[model samples]
Target chain A: MTVKSKHVRIKGIKDGLVFLLDDKCPFEDLLSELRYKLEHSHQNILTGPIVHVDIKLGSRIVTEEDKEAVLEILKSQGNLLIRSIDALEAPGSKENDEALFLMSGMLRSGQVLHHQGNLLFLGDVNPGGTITCSGDIYILGALRGMAHAGVEGNEEAIIAASLLSPTQLRIADIISRPPDEWGTRESSMEFAYLTNGAMQIDKIHNIVKLRQGLNVFKGV
Target chain B: MGEAIVVTSGKGGVGKTTTTANIGTALALQGKKVCLVDTDIGLRNLDVVMGLENRIIYDLVDVAEGRCRLNQALVKDKRFDELYMLPAAQTKDKTSVTPEQVRDIILELKKEYEYILIDCPAGIEHGFRNAISGADKAIVVTTPEHAAVRDADRIIGLLEQSHVESPKLVVNRIRPGLVKSGDMLDIEDILQVLNIDLIGIVPDDELVIKAANSGEPTVMNPDSAAAIAYRNIARRILGDAVPLMQLDRKPGAFSKLKKFFGMG
Candidate 1:
């Protein structure tokens, strides 16, 4: 009977989580090992809201009651829901998980906030201030300065703000208009997205149709 | 120890020297011992504005270079006995006195005066950094123009990162008529960009030029609108609550219509 952290590897997906279970181990041993690792939360994650999870059993045969046992173990530790039990790893689940950074307080003139992944800022960015993110940029407050999203050439990245009045905005390799041209001063929440290799501004509510797989959770 | 306040404006000709001279004089008039240090070095004007240029035996560089003592370098104001001026050298460039020397001079002045108002030179160069190095607080001066306000914003960012407390704003040379006609940037427009507490707003007054021509600070002129505005700023510095003086100049053509009807 062997139970290691590798037997129950947790991989993060785009909007959900994937759990890869070891196949060589005995059924009862794997269950006990999964229970032990989850009970301790080796990764120390998933204490937040209920997260959707997909289980991958590598060439292992398991009954419905055995799958229920695995679910019961994960459910006791935190809010986690098992979406599926497959024989192989899900596609596109191998990408390294990029965290979503959240920060409060406004950025004054000449101040800049840079993050590797997605950024969710809770304050304004005054003129001469800037925010650069490799992934998506979501600002809950006014953005009056420059914001460069997808700095690592991820063109799919979007920049959203409550008040979308920026001096300049850049998505991947594309740079938009100057202050006068970009000065729409939208009163409502809006987001700037790249479509057809051109940047466009729209209401925040339309983000669902803009990005696919972004509408992961529906009717909730 | 006295509180040293550095008056700075990133853009030139926005009234940094004028603000410092008047605020120092106004503080002296309140019976608080005040010293004004002109860090402009080559383009020394605070001394000229305060009518203390003639009395300067040694300037700031002389004091820093060990050619003269602090008392010998400071020019005593003619009108106010409690006010003094540390004139900048007329010949040397800004690099003559280092920031360390400026801090040392300020540390020494702190023991004797209630307030030390440092007149920072224009631009965010060596002189600007030296002026704010030892100050406890900062006052950013700018006119109601896009360029001036933009430069002031940059200066505020640098000051906030320095040892000094958050800098206050003073929108100098505001023209109410121009602002009313939407030609000039109003106080709110400037404040929105600067994003700092406003210490005062000095209206564009011809008397300020008249006073500067004679090497006299405008704060000494009781009837001048700019003088009153400067006085109110000095009061605010002393923790006194002074309402902002109305920007409508009484002698102006538009103001006369409102004044005659008692509606202004």
Candidate 2:
């Protein structure tokens, strides 16, 4: 039986089948049609070697009840699994996944570099230059200028530099200071991260051990 | 065609005008027809420094504004027959002359002179832009101080951006006592920071002040230490192998002791 529903559209992707749900359709009818399709639609590849499928609700707000209804309908199918359910319709999240911006050469005074995701600078950030980014920042040379990381208020962002003698540094809403004698230790590799609403800086290699030591202390 | 060199220091009172006057005079002494153009319009002091202030009948603005011919604005130097000074107008500010106007004036001067030295004003504003616009080469003057060196570095970057590649550095007003005592930046320190070719090092000589007050540049004095430095710089600009004089080392201990004892 061919069940033609106006609200339900199917797409075949590399992973599995993707059901594009329309928000105009009633939740009860949508779930029932999805269930009916899951049970009888063998030509749609619900049972063969394919194990999972994705559901994309375009411009639709899915509540907890709606999620339960979807899960309940998908649970009745024995071998098929729901891989992912994306309903927000946010822009750039998928396009900018793990995107990196690279800049090379000396950034002199009155120069500025702005990037959305992680910034990988292969040159020195001179005294009057600045770099601002929404994600993490990695500078392979000396950072003598200002670096504002986590510009989109991402508190988990980190800034690592080979020679971190920055004029100023900001991570999320927190500001940090370079050690007073930083220039004396020119080759010291350092990094900064937000901790307890404040930025903390430490040597790059010690961060892992410091976190592990904290975990051990919590265990004891 | 004559070489157009813009003498500029991003910071004021670092002897850019003085350097321009001295270098132009030094070049003229070697029988080269040199024309010194004062691009600092409002603060017109290059003429006064060169002792041509009283002879300024028609300034750069006069020539640019079509009030006088280009030769009428050229103030002849009293000391050297080949040397000349195109003085800036005292009443007008820097905007009275545009970059194109300055370039046109410099082009006109280039047809007559063997070297055209533009005395660029302090600060990287419209005036500095106007001065460096016509120049094919640049001479960056800086003192042995942090602020001066920093400004010099910025000027060098701007010069490179403006197509004046590899501007030579001339470190002025270096005190050997302060440098030897590790209290001030030395030539090597400045060279390390600016990272440009050092064309000259003019030591802190009282003769510069004496020469300036008399409205004659120090390069005209045959015996002044700064005069020798400027002369050597002029020779180097002519592609001569002139060694940078040791401005840091003082006279030997024996000479000092001899002077203290009032003996020769």
Go through the candidates in order and give each one's C-alpha lDDT.
0.86, 0.84
lDDT of 1 by residue, B1-264 (tens): 999999998999999988999899999988999999999989999878887777779989999999989998888889988899898999999998899999999999999999999999999889998899889999999999988887887788788779999899999998889999999999988887777899999988888998988988888988677888999999999999999878765556567556435687
* Model 2 alpha-carbon miss at residue A36, Å: 8.6
- The global Cα lDDT (0 to 1) of model 2 is 0.84
Model 2 residue runs over 4 Å out of place are A1-100, A177-187, A207-220, B250-264
lDDT of model 2 at position A90: 38
Interface RMSD of 1: 1.6
Tens-place lDDT per residue, model 1, A1-220, is 4354467788899878898888997777778888776766554676777788998887776666777788788778667887887863333332322556788876776788898888899988887788999899999888888999999999989999988888899999999965465554547998888988888888988888877666466675
User: What lDDT score is found at residue B175 in candidate 2?
Assistant: 86
Q: Clashing pairs in model 1?
A: none
